[model samples]
Every structure is written in structure tokens, then in C-alpha cells.
Target chain A: MLMIIRLMIAAMFILTTPWSGLAEVQDESALDIQVREIAKTLRCTVCQTENIWESGAPLAQQMRGVVRDRLKLGHSPEDIKEYFLSRYGDYIMMQPPAHGVNWLLWLGPFILLLGGGLLLYKEVIGWVRRTPANPTAPPPPLDEQARQRLERELES
Target chain B: MNKGTQLTLVLVLLGLFYLFYEGLWGNPRHIPTVLIGTDAPMVEGPDVETGEIISLEQFKGKVVLLNFWASWCYECKVEHESVLELHRLFKDNPNFVMLGVNYQDKLPDAQQYLKEYGTTFAHMRDLKGQLAIDYGVYGVPETFVIDQQGKIRYKYVGPVTGHMYTKITQEIIAPLLKGQPVSTAS
Candidate 1:
């Protein structure tokens, strides 16, 4: 009867004990965070626009696995990225490489904005220089007869 | 604008137009392979049916034809017969080897696929998809041909049928087997 009672107490304790599984899941390791960070940078080659982190395609999943495996093997994130780049070229990068003609893509918008701003500034300054000191030109210093006619008209 | 500035502007406009043209019309699927002149990845995996290990290392100094396929892929089903035919045409060549890589597939289903489709070559299981990633595979139905020196010479994505079959056999594999430099279009 004592042994049975001890066994029942053990079962209750076991049932009440919390499993660490939930905590384990909630606490994503540094490696997992690194994997997510790297995955976000890689373009899912099969998918047109989605990055590997956002893509549900099998290839994207496989790429993630590759990233994890490489990480475990002591390859740095840059090395892993370089490996992908060597295999798939610049297309594998979410933002294409900034070498060769691709520099234009990076600088094009700012260049256009600066150019447009300069053009507008030049036009505004030119208009300012071309305009007379007073916009109304002081009525050309109204001739005496013209002034008298304007006075008579006003009186009438 | 001065002459130099006008010329620069025209050139810039042309460049922009070219980029737009490439972005809108070029085939996104056609990623210019960086693997084609590089050393083929020395990959190893289990034989899908027999559970035996197979490695690219064992087939050193031979023309290796690696095909990546999955059971769920339809294009693989499309190229099944031609794959067998390609194997048959070149199997007698002592320097030629054909290997199929079962990617992202269950063992039983992959086995069933081989049985259903009729396989003439040994197929290896990609355990964790490392092999596929090592080969830089984007999707299934990709074929790669490695020269005797273990350099990947050609890679093609999609079903290896129709004109592709002829091209592989005649232009790619035939030349490689003869130790002639591959001068034809890949």
C-alpha cells in the first residue's frame, strides 16, 4: 500500500512537470538567427522576386539547408554568399553586384535628382537675372501728359 | 549642351534602354552558369534502391553525366525515355558514366519512380539536398556533363528531349569522349 502510494505521487509529479521543448522552440539559437539573416540576403533563384527567406519553394528550402550546413561546417556568411555567387553569378544576390554596369543602378536615381535640381536652380537664377528690378517697371516714369490724362479720367 | 555632354547623355539613354530591354524580355530562367568551366563538386550519396554508397570520386577520369530529378516533377517524367536512350547510346563507351540524383524525394517514392519510369542508370539519393546545392541546381530536370578532367563542361535545365538529346549525344558527350575540345554550343 505504501509502494502504490509512492508510485501515484511520482506519476503526479511527472505529469505536472514542464517540458523544456516549448522553451527550446521559443529560444531560437544564434545559429538559427544567423541562418535567417543570411537567407534573407539570398535571392531565391527559382522564384522571380522572392528572397530565400520569404520563398516556400523547395529550392529555397534546399538553399536554407545549404546555408545551415555551411554554417555548421565553419564557413562564414560571406564565404557562403561567395559560394552561391560563384555558382549562380550575380543573379543569386537579392541586390545584384555593384560592379561593371550595375553601378549605374545604384547611382542612377541620385544622379538624376542632382541633375534635375541643378537644372531647376539654373532656370530659376536665369529668370531672376532676366527680370527688371521692379516687376511693374514703375509705369515707365509716366509722361506728364499721360499723368494729366489719367487724373482727368479718374475725376470724370 | 556641349558636344561631350550631349554624347554622354545619349550614351546614358542607350544604356538605360538596353537595361530595360534585358529586364523585360530576357529569359530569367537562363542563369549563365558559373559551374561550366569550374571543377565539378565531388558529391557522394546512397544508391536509391540498393542503399549502397556512390561518389563522384570513384568515377575520376571519365565523362560523367549527372541528372537531377524528383518524383513529383513532371519534366523528369517527360525526359525519362530520352535519358535512357542517351545512356544506351553511350553506355558501351568505357569512359562514359551516367548518374541520376534523386532530389527532395522519399525513398519509397523514388524507388517507385525508377520502377515505373524504367531506369538504365544508377540513381543516388540526395540525403539532405547538399548534393543539389553543391551542383547549384535551381530545379529538377537539370543535366550536367563533366569532362574526364572532372571539369563541368555543360549544364542544361529542363527536359533533355527533342533537339537537346541529339545535342548532348553528338555535340557534347561525343566530343568529350573523343578527348576533343567542346567547341559547339552548350
Candidate 2:
């Protein structure tokens, strides 16, 4: 009877141990997913091309981990991103800050468009001014020979 | 058209072309460095094990692979083996060095991590992360390849893998050893 009991316990331990490993693996991958999600929103300081999640840089990876740990600790994503911004400055962010010097990064394109529109307007006005007013009267009809030559040129 | 108008039109067209060129061909992959080719920043902190004060200048005259990592970083764990491999690969190569900077980690946690992972290189704690700021480190696991001349030659912003290991050996290390300019991908 004792031997049978020992066998049952051993079986139970074996079954349960694998579950622990599975749980750990699940937790780890869950963490990875969360980190990736957060990293996707944060810019990579080094690459300047993609967010930290998309970047292959070790630093970006590390930052992803930082985000994950912060999430685990219950810090809001905004706070975590803000923490990094405070430390590394707006240049580290893929999206420039909305205030201060980076206000230009946000508003520069619109400003450029306005300037371009003004320039276009000025050029069009200048061209209209320089162009001789369209002749009020139509030109005389060309002779048959001239018309034939023009037709030939068009055909060729 | 007036000369000024014509000139302005040409200039605007040229600017558009330049913008397109930058969008397509600029060094998008290159991480902007506030510290490229600059001397290693001043870092003073306790060594990972000994609690001895360590500074960046101490690693002068050697090629340093300064890695920023944290215990909480998952990718750091993923690339931990690669770091160990690098440490082993260059164990006897005194000219090459690997240093870890524990970014914003508590001492006990950092110690537990070293114990768990097996420390292959000396690490310094970046208590205030001023070192990371100085190095322009935006994220963890950023590796800087400093040449023997003490100038930072390359910066890898992500995980170091077997393929990257081979590439580093061929493109960065071999060329530097041959006294040639480092061929950067950017």
C-alpha cells in the first residue's frame, strides 16, 4: 500500500513540475509581448528610424525590458515613456515633443506649406504681370500655303 | 519669367529633390550619437562584485565593448549568452575588453543577476544613469565598440547575435586591426 502511495506521489510531482515550467514559459512570453507592445510606441534613440520594438539595437531591447519591468511594477505607459524622455531628451523619441524647441518639429511642415503657398502666389502674380495681356483681337487667318505647312508639321 | 521668379522656382524644385533624396537615401539605420568618436564619458561607481570604485578612464588603451543592460530587460537575458560568448572569445585577447553598465538597477538585484548569469566581465553600476546619459544611451543592451585608440568606432543599438558577431569580427574589428577606417553600414 505504501509503495502504491509513493508511486502516486511521484506521478503527481512529475505532472505538476512540467506545469511550473509551462507557467514560467507562458509568463516569460507574455512579458515579451507586453514589452514589444510598449516598445512599438517608443522611439529608438540610436537608429532614429523605428521605434524601440522595431529596432534591433541592444539598447532598444534593453529599453523594451525597462518598459516591461515598469509595466510589471504598475507604472502607467505614459509615465514610463515620460521617465525616459526626462532622462534622454526629446531627441530620443521618434515623435518629437509638442512643446518648446520641438514645437517646430510639430508645426514646421504647416509653416513650410504656408510659405510655399505664398511664394507660389507671388510667382503666379509676377508671371501674370509680365505676360502681355492676351491680344484683345484674334490674329488674322494664315494663308492656304502656311496652313498646309502647319498641317504637314503637325502630321510629321 | 522674371529672373527672380525663375530662380525661386528652381530653388523650390531643388529643395523638393533634396528632401526626397534624404527620405530615401539618408542614413536611416544609423543611430545618432551624441558621443561618437568622443572619449569615453566619466563614470564612477562600485564594481559589480567588489564594490570598488571604478571609472571609465581605467579601461583606457584597450578596445572596450561597453554594454548597457539591466536585470529587468528581457532582451538582455536573450543576448546574455552572446555577451558571455564575446567574453570567452576575447578572454585572452588583452587588447579587447567587455564592460557592462548596469543602468538604473538596484545593487541587490544586480548582484543576484550576476550570480545567476555568471559574470564574465567587470560591470559598473550606473546609479544615477549619468553615465548612460553621457554615452547617449537611450535604451538598454546598447553596445558601443570603442577602438584601441579610445575613440568609439561603432555602436550597435540592439541584440548581438551570432551573425552580428561574425560581422563585427570581419567589418569592425578586422579593419581596425589593419589600421583602416571602419566600414560603417550607415
Candidate 3:
């Protein structure tokens, strides 16, 4: 009976230790996933065309780690992003900020759209104003000098 | 119109034209990039050789140079020399560390490429693309320079050469080494 009890206790410890270790590893991996999600939105400065998440560049990888560390330290996502922005400038963001000098990056297209709409409106109004109301009104007689000039131009 | 009035009008028009030109051609200096100075994202993956789990947190308090690359990317291959150079330069500098993230390439291919290039830097295989996504990587050959404080200080988006290395070192690394706050702009 004593031997059986000791054997059972040893078995339990052996089984539970690995399980606990596995759980801790899983937790760490989960935290990594969370950090990765936040890093994906940032652009890599070295490869301006690629985001930090996609590039295999060394710097991107380091920055991803840095972001993770900051997250672990209890910094909010926004704080992490702002911290990078202050050091690297707007080029580091995949999407440029809308404030300060970068507002144009966000608003330039809308401004162009409005300007285009206004120009189209003006053109349509000018066309309407130039059109005569009555289609069948006899055409105003041309002055003799104007008629002569038109005839000469057409002939040439 | 009098000459003075004509001159004034001309000057105003010129000024307006200049403003538009600047708007089109000039990006504002020191406009903060969204990711600049931000905390780096956590990235973890299997070690390229050992298949052991590697986490970014392991290298805390060291200046890290994270490089993203691939076996098939031509620009990455072009920049490989500079990467090797940087490694050689900083190999003895305990405060500096460089990590290579293999983006979307087979493990064998990446290992072979690195072998051919003679790189001694440590690398992680981001086989499932999870690590890459965390860094917001759009393509390979991007680099991020993180300071000892773990803030991302510099980013280089394309193939880097010797000239780029010098410029970045002078503008970013040298300042940090001297205990001065780095200027974020070129």
C-alpha cells in the first residue's frame, strides 16, 4: 500500500510539471501574437515601400521586438506609435497622420474633388447662360463687315 | 495699371504659384512618421537553425538592427553586402545586435543564401507570416534601427548601400552613442 501511494504521487508530479511548462510557453506565445498584430500597421523606414511586419529586413525585426517590449511594459498602442513617430517622422507610418503638415496627405484628394465639382458647375452654368431660350428665333443678322470676314476666313 | 500696382499683382501671383509648387513637391521636414520613436512590436519565431522559440524580448537594453529579407528578393540580395558589412563593423560592439527576419522563404533556401553571403548574424524564420505581419512589412529588404532604450530610431525602406550606412550612422547612431537625443529627420 505504501509503495503504491508513493508511485502514484511521483506519476502525478511527472505529468503535471510538463503540462505547467507548456502552459507558460503557450501564454508567452499568445502575448507575442498580440504584439505582432499591433506592429503590422507600422511601415518600415528602411524599406519605405514595405511595412515593418512584412519586411524580412533586420531593422524591421528589431523594431517589432522593440514594440513588443514596450507593450509588455504596459504602454498603450497609441503611445508606442507616437513614440516612433516622434523619432522617425511620418514616413514610418503605413498611413500618414492627418494633423500638422501631413493634413494635406489625408485631405488633398477631397480638396481636388471639391474643386473639380465647382469647375464642372461653372462650366454647366456658362453653357446654360450662353444658350438662347428660343430655338426657332431667327438668327440675328450679321453685320456686313462681320459676314465678309467670316466668308473670307472660311474660304481660306 | 501703374507699374507699382502691376508689380504688386505679379509678386502676389508669383507667391501663390510658389506656394502651390511647394505643396506639390515638398514634404514637410520633421513631420513625424507614425511609427517613428514608437515602441517596437513584439515578434517571436523559431530560430532558423535550432527551431527553438526566439523572442525579441531576449535582447532588451541592446541597440538592435532588425533586417527583413528573403531568398528570392533581388534587392535584398543586393543589400546583403551592406548587411554583412554592418555585422562586421558592429560584431565587437556589445551594445549592438542585428537580427535577420526571413520573410516568406523556405528555411533551406534562406539558410543557403545566408551561407553564400557569409552572414554571422542571428536570424528567425517567420514561416507562417505572423512575425512579418507584426512588423507591418510590405516586402523584403526593410530595416529598422532600434535604440538601446528600445525605441525605434531609424527606418530604411529599400536597398541600403555604404553611403546610406554612413548617413544613417552619422545622423542617428552617432548621436545616440554620444548620449544626445537623435534628430528624426534627414
Q: Evaluate every candidate with DockQ and list the scores.
A: 0.30, 0.07, 0.09
Q: Write the per-residue lDDT of candidate 1 for residues A1-156, one digit (tens) a residue.
A: 999999999998777665565566655587899899999999887776788999999889889988998998899999999999987888788887899877876777666666656656766888999988878655558889999999999999
Q: How do the residues A29-136 of candidate 3 rate in per-residue lDDT, one tens digit apiece?
A: 977887777778777655645777888876677788778888888898899888666555566777877788567657655655655555567668879999999979
What is the model-wide C-alpha lDDT for candidate 1?
0.87
10 residues in a row with least lDDT, candidate 3 chain B: B23-32
Which of the predicted structures, 2 or 3, would earn the higher DockQ when compared with the native?
3
Off by over 4 Å in 3: A1-117, A133-156, B1-33, B50-54
Ranking by DockQ: 1, 3, 2
Report the poorest 10 consecutive residues by lDDT, candidate 3 chain A.
Answer: A110-119
**On residues B70-156, what C-alpha lDDT tens digit does candidate 2 reach at each position?**
998887888898888878877677677778999878889999998998877899988665577667775677888888777878777
lDDT (CA) per prediction: 0.87, 0.75, 0.74
Q: Which ten residues in a row have the lowest lDDT in candidate 2 chain B?
A: B22-31
Best TM-score among the predictions, by candidate number? 1
Kindly list the per-residue Cα lDDT of model 1 for residues B107-130, writing each as its tens digit.
999999999888888999998878
- lDDT string for model 3 (B1-186, tens) is 455754665565555556556544444322334556778776788877778887888877887889998999999989888888878877787777889998878999988887787778789898765565555554677788888777878777678787777866667666665657876653
Over 4 Å off in model 1, which ranges? A1-28, A107-156, B1-27
Q: Quote the positional error of residue B153 for candidate 3 in Å.
A: 1.5
DockQ of candidate 2 against the true complex:
0.07
